[model samples]
Target: MSSPGPRRRGVSVPRPGRGWWVPAWAVLLAVVLLGPALAPGLVLSYDMVWVPDLTLRSDFLGLGSSLPRAVPSDAVVSVLDEVVAGWVLQKLVLLLPLVGGALGVVRPLRDLPLPARLVAVSLFVWNPFVAERLVMGHWPVLVGYGVLPWVLLLGRRWRVERRLPAALPVLVVAGSLSASAGVVTAVALVASVGLGSRTRAAVAVGLVAAANAPWVVSGLLHAAAGRSDPAGAAAFALSGEGSLPAPLAALSLGGIWNSEVVPHSRTGILAWVSLLVLLGLALAGGRRWWSRGRRDAATLAICWGVGLGLALLTWASPDAVAWVAAHVPGGGLLRDGSRQLALCVPLVASLAAVGTTRVLEWMEDAGAVMVAAALVVLPVLLLPDAALGVDGRLRAVDFPRDYADARAAIDEDAGPGDVLLLPLASYRQPAWNAGRKVLDPTGRYQSRDFVTSDALVVSGTVIAGEDPRVAEVARALDLPTPDERADALVRAGIGVVITDLEAPGEPPEVAGEPLLRGSRLEVSALDGARSPAPPTGWLWAMAAAWAAFVVPPVGVAAAAVVRRRRRRDTP
Candidate 1:
């Protein structure tokens, strides 16, 4: 028998330098197309009220004020001027991963093709939660969650390129600085490195430091506040074991993709085809990994280890529990573990992309199947509660149209700091309707999103669930009527009155200057308060901030443009 000749190992064909541009362009195109649909404030369900509730205006940016009570630290607020800046910071966090993916896809990485790179970028830049974050303004979480994947990808590149010494520390520092989300991401990145032995010790150190950094910082911050709690919140892993049904648990994973807040305008027959394609890719990737041997196994293992480890930490969340016990001194500050799952989704998406690529290589003919799966099954499997909600106070719907009209009618008649004696719950309504800052707003206790629960109502009322005053108020706010309540507003020196027109009883009697009447709201005022000067210092600060975010990136784009133009002209 003749000895078998050496078998050829399958190798990925490398492309030229110019090809890298394609991935960047493709991602940019996708983002631009999806911009209008995903960029608005429509996707945010609960945080909508909170962001604006915290909105304060200072002379700094002329952007207006911020909520004094929203942040835990005066130090953080002192450095940051506007609530909008804070909101932007949060949006940046969410966008960071997409930025990283774009970098990896477009930058001069070795041994990757334009298409392969673009797919990697799309796996994250196209994430649904990212779009939601842009609206909601969970800056710390978004920032932390978004930066990790790029760190991991960079770690992988450093190993392949023999630049571990320099890249490792950079990765560690970047990972540690992002706060809680960063810590979790750093842990995941190290876990990925450990799956392969090349930079195991360095990776291990980075992971350990990443995991512990928040606890250290949070601890110090809390200690400065002069308080500590030794016990923490119960671990969700154990506590939620029975509370969540299997279906709901699955939904939690998928529900983040679609929300009750946003309209689903893209749904059509194309959906079915997308589902099939994603499914085909997953199946194909799985088969390829199993047959490819140890190197592929190790790579997949690293990805899985990092992703799964973060998931488990979030599941257990002893750190979070302990932080809560210590009253969020250093570590417990980022109370929810669910935020870490944001990073996990992208990691899983990357795996999905890898799987799709492998399937394409193996079957060569089943690309259509992958697209179908993405369109149909994935959406079905992930999101079941796609129904849009109607506006109601009880259901937590702040009617936008009614609120806007009411606010307009009232603002025309009111001045700065003049009390608008609408229903107490009217303050809880949307800003466009409320006309002035509300004395109280409706929020949840132990909230999953915003932390204004205690402040939303006057306590005990929510626990008893039977404040007759609250019930009566809710009924009255639903309709503006001439009752004893209207007489009380004039007595209380309320300058303007805004209401929803249809009240259970007669409209409230107004004593102040009558401005105008809409179908929903009434406006009047006793006096107009002096409008304060804009905070010139704050505007300069905001100008600095806008510069901070926009200038560097624009410079890079300008350089790229010049380079491309020069290249074209050279020919």
Candidate 2:
């Protein structure tokens, strides 16, 4: 094996302070990519709903009647939005990952030259995987993907130095924002930080479990609430984008099931070019990476192989995966196989960086620099549509004035029942949002328990949701006459009904004068209902789990502070 050195022949590692260019370039690329999407209003897209304020409730903590897909993510936002505007927080959530991901990908290849670092950052921050997930509005998933490199570094630090990373627990918590995020994070953590030392392995296990506790506890708490339809496993399975085949698509990191979110560029020649570049780089740098990062290479193999296998299984053998999702508790998370593909990123970014360095080594100074610069720009040319708000699918828009009016009217009464939305649909293609499809934002917009349809309809296929209360509420809406309907809704625990003016549905009438009426919404109160339920004992358990997940990282960070102080004082 080659000896470790700061300056290797033909490779040009960065001098200290000069490395600022890496993250600055990453931030610049992110700005170019996000473009208009970073404007003042909320950037609402598929599953990416942010409101002015989110009411903290048991439902937000996964004590809801349905699944905990948004669990700690919603809860986290609730806390953050208080300190920051939701619009600004949304932008930060979208921005931090791209910049952070670039830095993380560059960390492992610190010994490599500028060409290598630039290429890794470009590919990591601006690729089909990042593009598709961003357009799909899976912010937490991107957050998880961003943290994988740090997880790898932690494993290496422990393997070589036998020292636990102070930020180890923090990284896991960042990655474990959602159940799917937690699952992929766990895979990366285990693959990179295998059970070599008994003590480290034990700590790793505890960290993994603690990080995953929010979603796991939420899922278990609501386990008796319902089960997802087995059919979802097939519906959400990874598939080829446009004309590309599934396997090639997977290898190229371009297979996301929802074609709507895919950039138009992926449907054509850029796809093949990306595939070629990925394979060429891997082959070119494979040897160097193998020599330097043997353990990392093994971890990469496990992660990529397992990720690809699971991604394909969801497409080819949905029946088997569907069985697991049906029979296993908290297994529905595996239904979206495309998420696991995040596992393939660490090695790709690392190898691509070193590959550029190796390729540059063959040419003289001027030629090599130009080639490296061209490679840095090539990722942009290949996926040009990823920039400017993902081909303009992502743009900021303010909520209708009626939303605030309705909330204010409802806020005054301090009524009993949970808020109920009209139209009874799970997803909304709101006119206010330029007809972009989003999970209804009303639930998060108001300071009340807003019950919405749990079922999701994708590509004309309806995947039943877990909440049985959705059915009872739907039945209440079907009752004859305004009085009977109002009575049924109140008895069924609907405190108020807020109907969207733009949505296509006949909102049931209430006998009394409406509380608030506007161009966009009609708010009516049901007089007989009781106020929202108080916090159950389960909420304390949920809080404790979140505290457990967070406290270790706090302790570690505090200890680091103390040690630094002691060293300074002695000197």
- Among these predictions, the greatest TM-score belongs to 2
lDDT for predicted candidate 1 compared with the true structure: 0.39
User: Per-residue lDDT tens digits of candidate 2, residues 90-172?
Assistant: 89989888888789878877777776788988988888888899888899999999888788778667766888778877888
Error of 2 at 399 (Å): 1.5
TM-score for each prediction? 0.47, 0.94
Candidate 1's displacement at residue 428, Å, is 6.2
For each candidate, how many residue pairs have backbone atoms clashing (under 3 Å)? 56, 2
Q: Go through the candidates in order and give the C-alpha RMSD of each one to the true structure.
A: 11.5, 2.4
TM-score of candidate 2 versus the correct structure, residues matched by position: 0.94
Model 1, span 1-571: residue lDDT tens: 0111112125332233465454455446334423432333322333323222232223112232212122222123324425344335323333454565455433322223334444545544543334334333344444444455555555556555544433334334434433454556555555545444646646456444533332343333224442322222232221121233222322122122213322232233323333444455566555443444344245445544554444444445655555553553344433334445564554344345445444334332344345423432343223222211111111212334444544554446455432333444322323442232232322211011111112122222221211222343334334454444434433333334544344333544545566656555555554533333334654454445434323433554566678779999996
**How does each model score on lDDT?**
0.39, 0.82
